[model samples]
Target: MVGARFFNFILFFAGLAVAFNVKTIPLNADHYVKVLVLFWLFSTMYHHLRVLHKTGNTTVDYGISYSLSFGIFAGPLGLFIFETIYRFTVYFNKKRTGTDDPEEFSDTFYNIGAFVLTYSAAYYLYNLLRPVFELFPFGYWILIFLLVCITSLLIDLLLIIVFLLTSDIKTVREAVDFIKSRSILDMGKTAFTNGLLLLFLREGEWGALFALFFLNYLVSRSFYSKSQSIKNKIERDKFEQMAYTDFLTGANNRAFMDKRMAELDETGEYIGIVVADIDNFKHINDTYNHSVGDQVIRHFAKTLKSYINGNDNLFRSGGEEFTLFLRNRNYRQCLDLVERIRRGIEESAVEAEYGPGTASISYTSSFGLYFYRIHHKVSMEKGYIQADQLLLTSKQHGRNRITALDGSNKQGNMPVSIPKQKLVP
Candidate 1:
């Protein structure tokens, strides 16, 4: 990525140098100073309005900067000087704060080169269209202004895409998507503002030009604040999700399951709990090391996940143990789902390599299902306890069997074992 960015910088600078030599536009000292001051103010405002998203970097400053360069009639040299000062200021500020990452330097150089090339291209095109601007009606001039804005934006996007392609930050698709997702209204506003600024300059309306600059600053600041608020909310949501997710198996953790159970309890709907444990998990760890054991756990979790219906949720309660919460399901439906999951696990194998050879190891899981009607008012804790007891019974009888709480029994103490069948080839 660094190399790519460097190559882009070289290309931009070379093109810019060529444009400057082709037709040098004599810069007015007064206009250059005024434009530089306006550019500085807009750049500062742009930084203040910057939004840092979780996915990547984004700023509204580019639009404002480009607009100022084009509107002020700053020659290529003047624009280059303006960008250089801006880049230097940024670098010095970062250096003072001890936040000068290596990438910042590369980015600063890339921006400087990109801005010079972009403005030079726009200026050259605007000059070429000057004859048409005078020959055609006012409406044609508007079209020409829009063409200039679009051309500059395209150049900016091309540079950005090139930078992204070289970096590990984002894929080409993602970069294009991000650009496409940009607010069209914002782009239109920027383009309109640039055209207005150019008109003010042509008419020698100094007061209106400065007024518009400040107004744009205020608008950009508002956008920045709103974007920051949205970014914060998204980050908070991401953190919350991370907290509730099991890192090892990518399933909801026990805490999330408990929270979900509370929500389900309030719905007054029938709920079923199926607690599953890998049979002889410790033996796998002993024979093939913990890495293979972890692989087995993840495989089993994925297999169990496949059997879960839309109305059900899966959770990895802890090591070698998982739970499924079925909503709006009766005893029969829940049993059938659990039995299917059990059969799937019994037939599936996890392939792993040992020292020099690979082996496919088949495994089984024991399930304990406890179902409660809507009116039973059974707490999640109580359900868990009943399911756990049944699971213990299944393990006591044999490792590869299911023990289900018999709903017909009034005492709530009976668990029935499902007939164990041999694995089919």
Candidate 2:
């Protein structure tokens, strides 16, 4: 609180000094109103169009270029009047629109004071540097104008950074990203536009000012719209990922499995539809709790995922049941992979809460496999149904075993092969 008061005092002191100096600029009423309206429009619109956010107290004003041009055109006293009046207007605009946040009210004074000081500094700096470059080409005029803009930007940034640190750096990393997080290209854009505005303002070119102001807004809106597009795309992709992923096990969910199955006939690759079910999952849940049951599910899913490749997909189709779609694998490969995954599950132990502490609980699983090439009379959906039926057969005969069937033999009466339950030993 003392630190905040200290900052307030410094800012208000600078603002008050500028406030007491009531000297005026030489522009007529018509020209004065034109410049003031341009400043107001640029300032207000830029706030809405801003794509970046402040890092703590370090606010990046994209309107700094406009503020610089206005400050230099008017003197310290005139700039001071605009800053105080304009910021309060911003506060009221937020309130009228029902978008006023508490921070907006609290920071109003800090904003008015600090912005007044920043613009006032630009006014003096530009005046001091103007005569030094009188002999150089018009390029030096651009250089001096840029220096004023940069100096004002730095001063405003420094004040905010100091205020934030006075509150403390325990909140941020030592590797604080200042510019990269706030794009330098964005600042360059505003600075370039503001420089041109200043050149036309001094030359009394109202027609050019009107044209440039319109063009500047168009360019600014174009950049802001592009940024919003990228941001929305990223958010959309993230939501889609969340939708297709199982929350508990991080495996693909039924939704993605269904979508992948719908697209499989086009590939014409050999496909194996396998269903794996946890052995006595209800018993595990009854013996411990749902938390332990979840751990077991996750461990089982992880083991299954470890066995699959890029051409394979694992889905948590149910609480205790998982489905695997393996591509480009024959009957032998499908049988071997299912057996290995089943054995892996049977041999693994998951650490779970037991009484007062934790214990390693070993578990097992059963699998059913249906191997076939796509474009056959047996569709992917039919293969999945057949595999699911075989899965029920594996569970009924005995748990912790695999039942295998070739898609070509689905109609024939071949005896189902059940692997010896590994837990029998």
Candidate 3:
């Protein structure tokens, strides 16, 4: 919100400054409008350049070339020329990308194009009226004004309908339907045409002032598109993050763990699988509030995450239990890793958002480590079972500690041989 407000302020101030500076440029309002329009084109180009430099997106270069070419040849046909090309490009790109319904392109292209056409027409209308005020008598101006509104509204409505109907509209057809359903397109056109009339009223000419409207719309439209795009991307990115993340613990969820494991397996990379569980979690839920119990679980998960290396994966499989996948590590190394994680959870504190604590309470966790030998001819399902068995052994012996296939305890760093038993056939 703060960012959006700041951007608005920046654009507003920048427009005023651009206007004040251009006022000195000694051209009729029409020519002055063109100058400022050029400014807008340059400003947009600069913005694209900044994006390209920051993100290393070669696509921005394409945009830069497009803008430059459009700016050079666009002239009085600026809105129509640019929009027609832009819509075509977006339509083609959507087709190439293989998206089922690229609805955003339709909404964006149509909405933006509608706005541009409206502004351009308004500019022309205002210019057309200038000769009227200079030549026409009293009641004639009123008639022209009313006639202009009606005519412009008709044209604006037709343009709006055309845009909504055409372009990459399949994805956004519903949105278009809804917009048209609510009569917003009609309302928007009326509002915009009226706004341009008011602009003419303010300055008594269509020249530089029309360009001001154009600048204002360009800035506003750019901001709106960027913000909406960012919001959508944020939603998609957040969902992607959440899809892989555990809801309760905010760790990687089971599905994500499986994905990582499969990748490691495919590459024949050695990984230690540690399955950790909170001690007496069920009792905690039964004794304290489930909410507090949830906090404890969350704390345990976070602590476990803190102990892992960058290459390691920590996932919550279900209630009170988590799975860890660490790459390029042996049984002993895995044991040490699990022990560190267990100790971290035992010692670390977690702030209770809805639980009892001065500030927060600490929780402990027990972990079971199993060496997953990629070299061994074992199925992934079998390896997971082996890891689970190690977890069961850890719980059976004691809680609040680490247990490995080597039988090494969390406190003692020494390795212990696994008791060979074919738990799963």
Candidate 4:
């Protein structure tokens, strides 16, 4: 609440300063009306095209309207009025939809403060450089324009950093890094367009001004359309990823394994399948709780991931069960990898919370590995069944063991399990 009040106070004073600057400048009511109409049109168009996040947060709309205000020699007063009207319009629109959040109001003030400060600094620098600019040839005006644009961009970036700090949105280093990653080329393009419009406005060519306004409107529409398309693509990718990702262990889910199996079959590649199960997982769940059991599962999954190399995929097949797909690896290699993972799991301890304290719990797992060539008339399901049978054999032999089919049995017509190797520590 104190921070909110501080932001409001800054906005009040900033508004006063802008209002005072307007009073000092010669009143051109007619020109102000003309600029206001043009600004309002662009603002309205951009407003409707703006994208609103599902969370009700809105992305920052492009500052084409503000750029035009500066281009037309609209003093600080004109820009302030334009911003005020725009804010009120947005506020009322959101109010009608019952989405007018208090934070939105604060954001409006924040944006207004940013604009006034940036434009004020740019106006001051423009005046300071005008004489020096006149001494140079005509094309040198671009330099003055570039410098003023840089000043505005720098001030805007500084205010964004300050906002990040005050609102606790990010640390100073993070804010700086964010600004550094932004595209300066985009900023320069906007400034160059504004500079061109400024030149036309100075020459009193109303036709060119209106034409440029239309062109800017079209450009904004194009950008809005492209941004919407990109946003949709990102959303679709996120959904696809979620569909195939395990919620508990962060491994690929069974569905993903099925898809990969189909793809591997099409390529007719020899693949090794390994099935692993945490020994006595139900005992862990009953001794502690499901939460502790989940922790153990996640820890075990992390250990399993450590053993994966190129072209090796791990999946959470179901509760307490995991599957690994090893491509182009023979039975011996797969057996060695799974044995290493089983040893790693045994050595790993998970911190599980219980009631008032946390306790480190050591756990063990059993693995079953089977290797098969795709073109040898063996199905992926048959391979998984063979591995599952070996996994059961390990569990029966006493948990924490590996039961893998020998390489010589790879071409067998039926499922075959070799002798189990107990790895109890």
Candidate 5:
């Protein structure tokens, strides 16, 4: 919309200003080169406008292609015409690809296509017009044409892949960010190689070739900061995830719960802490083997997750032990939740066989429950100790039961026990 039109206008005016500043000779050959330059500029501007329409921004890809067009035309007029056709031909009837909106991919494709066409056209025009003035020796002409083809092909291949990969992205800003952060080194290497070829093989052109190589070096150097920045971001994210996650159960770990407790304390919110342990866990591993015990632990973790509130967190604190942090919940309601979890584990059968019914196994869990009070100012370590004391009580009295601590200030509260419920095999 307004943004697209604004960018298009900007590109057009900027190209025009550049075009007007080009050196012009009154002679026929000079005039023709100038025309080609104008064409190159216009075509490039048009293509960029198409890019803006699709991706909402212009990028380094577009800028590089524009620079190549400048090299091809050697004058503003040729550049304008080539760019203008590129804009119209590539974008006029382009369909959107899954990777990119129609406009962006089209603009990239057209930029590449336009370079091929304009370079071909400009070279041909130069040859035809130069014959009249006996300018541009055959050796020089052949070298330019050969170099143009090689450079265009290389740039096209690289840019085409980038376009295909990134078209689906929302904006040119994101696309460029991706390139800057991830792919710049590869591009710089390619540019360096190409520049090296021009410097070493093309006699008498070492100065220009060296300039291009230096430009490539500078471009490569520019990306070091961006690449390091992205690397830091990725590393930071990975560290954060590792800090909070249990690799075995894919559940929150103790560190994550501790952080949540800090938040709860700051808010002075009510929370229910439920500690659960697999009943006679040692016996199960001894009876069926450790592998089966592992399966039971995984199954228990998955089942427990289903019964939790949206805001609640489930943690695998240790072997056969888990903790749930339920926000804004009281002791009675937490007891009810614990009972339901117990019943669920008691009734559900886990197939010992990772496969069919023939190898199935069954397991059950006992829970220790405690609710946090707004008036309580205890640390997570102390809360966990209190819950562990209740768990020992459950194990000592009988397995497969729920034991809760009353909402009391007295530090050593006895376990509030439930009846032993037998689980069906």
Candidate 6:
């Protein structure tokens, strides 16, 4: 941190020295026109400059491109005014959005210092290389512009490296990685375009210059649009998943079951609707506690869910109650599935703490399965009602058992339980 603050002071002093000289202001019509053009360009592109997000709270805005052009075209004094105003406006905008939380606004100081130093360096470089253009006097301007932009970019990267090395990062590797994370392609592209912009401005071709800027804006806007679209889609999917999920057991909730059932078609394919509840759940809650009862519910749901396949959906529709929807399954298939789930629940144990003592709570569940094909004349609501009634029969006959009914027959089947189940109400 000390190193970074020291570096900021040095950069600020260098920028101040360049600002005091004030040798690059406009003195003629053509020079004033050039400055006006740069101002126009900056105003148009300020809001759209590509901002690259970094790991920390730091971001690298491509505003430096404008600063480089502004400095070389308008000189040091103009560069100083432009950077100060732009960065202050950015800081206030952050304030409007409730995000103006920097350490005594050090980031603003650092940004102003770093950018001013970079732009000032570019301006001086142009001064040093002015002799080369005079020597060639035959179209060596483009080369000089390219050299200036590339050198400015290197200086920008170097300053950032110094800042990162002393910032809150833990290691040299992490500091270097911050520099590496910048887009090399973007760097090359910006430099190349700045070269073209310089040539156009130097040659005093206003029409071509504006056209090039328009093209750049169009490309940036296109990328931003596509990126926002993808981001919005991901957020929508996340919301939908959360809406349909039960928070306790990570199973589909009652809302999701209603949606899936609503979309089903009334056809010949058998649909299995199983409504199961933990046997003596209130007893468990009373014996241990609600938290322990919750564990028992989760254990039962997990055991039942393990037997469900991709074609089925299991839901925690209520406390200590779960529902399953099995598609394209016959009567025997549905019965066998219910048997496996019941046995799974019978074998599983829920671990919980009871009055400061740990205990393994063994429990069981009762299921009522209504296996049938829906008739257009009868709504599927009847299926759930029949299954619920069958659940009551299982609880009445005994717990730890399944009572199934095949409802597509001429004569409706009464309660049918697994013969091997022992009575344990």
Q: Between prediction 3 and prediction 6, which has the larger TM-score?
A: 6
Off by over 4 Å in 4: 1-32, 47-62, 65-72, 76-81, 84-87, 93-99, 103-125, 137-183, 283-295, 340-363, 375-378, 406-425
lDDT of 5 at 349: 81
Off by over 4 Å in 6: 1-13, 18-22, 25-65, 68-78, 89-106, 119-177, 265-269, 351-358, 419-425
Q: Which digits, one per residue and each the tens of the lDDT, describe model 1 over residues 48-83?
A: 355443334322234444434352376676666777
Model 6, 1-425: lDDT tens per residue? 66666766677677778787776574465665665555555544655545555445455455325566666766777777677776677677777777665532566676667767777777787778767776665435555456554655566575566556556466777666655665656656656666677677678787887787777777777887787889899999999999999988989898988887777644546788899999999998888789888777777778878898898889997888898888778888888878877877777787777677777999888889898887675445677777888888889887778888887766976667753343222
Candidate 3 global CA lDDT score: 0.54
Per-residue error for 278 in candidate 1, Å, reads 1.6
- Model 6 residue 374 lDDT score: 76
lDDT tens readout by residue for model 5, 1-425: 34443433544555555544554422366544544444344443333332121222334333233334244434444445445555555445343323344345434444434444444444345446545444546544344444445554544444434344555455667546544443443434434453343334224354554455456445544554566688799999999989899877788888887887777666665667788889878987887778778888888999999999788889988888999887666666777778888998988987765433434666677777776664456765567777877777777777788778765435855567785553211
Give the number of the best model, judged by TM-score.
Answer: 2
Prediction RMSDs, each to the true structure? 5.4, 4.0, 16.6, 5.1, 16.6, 5.3
Candidates in order, TM-scores: namely 0.76, 0.84, 0.45, 0.74, 0.51, 0.77
Which one wins by lDDT: 2 or 6?
A: 2
lDDT (0 to 1) per candidate:
0.72, 0.74, 0.54, 0.71, 0.59, 0.72
Give the CA lDDT, 0 to 100, for residue 412 in model 1: 68
Q: What is the lDDT of residue 98 in candidate 5?
A: 36
Q: How do all the candidates rank in terms of TM-score, highest first?
A: 2, 6, 1, 4, 5, 3
Cα lDDT of model 2 by residue, 1-425, tens digit: 45665666577677867756746755676777777877777677666675545545444345434666777787666667667667778788888999665556545677767766777777787778777766678855566557654664565465445546455333344325442244455556656766787889989888898788777778878978898999999999999999999999999899998888889867777888999888999999998889889988998999999999998899998888999998877877888888888877777799877779997999888888888777757677887888898898898887788887776445754526566543211
lDDT over C-alpha atoms for residue 254 of model 2: 91
Candidate closest to the true structure, highest lDDT:
2
Residue pairs with backbone overlap in model 1: 1-166
Model 4 lDDT per residue over 49-124, tens place: 6544321232344444344335237766666677667777777787788967666676677656666656755666
Q: Where does candidate 6 clash, by residue pair?
A: none
- Position 194, candidate 1: lDDT: 71
Q: Which ten residues in a row have the lowest lDDT in candidate 2?
A: 171-180
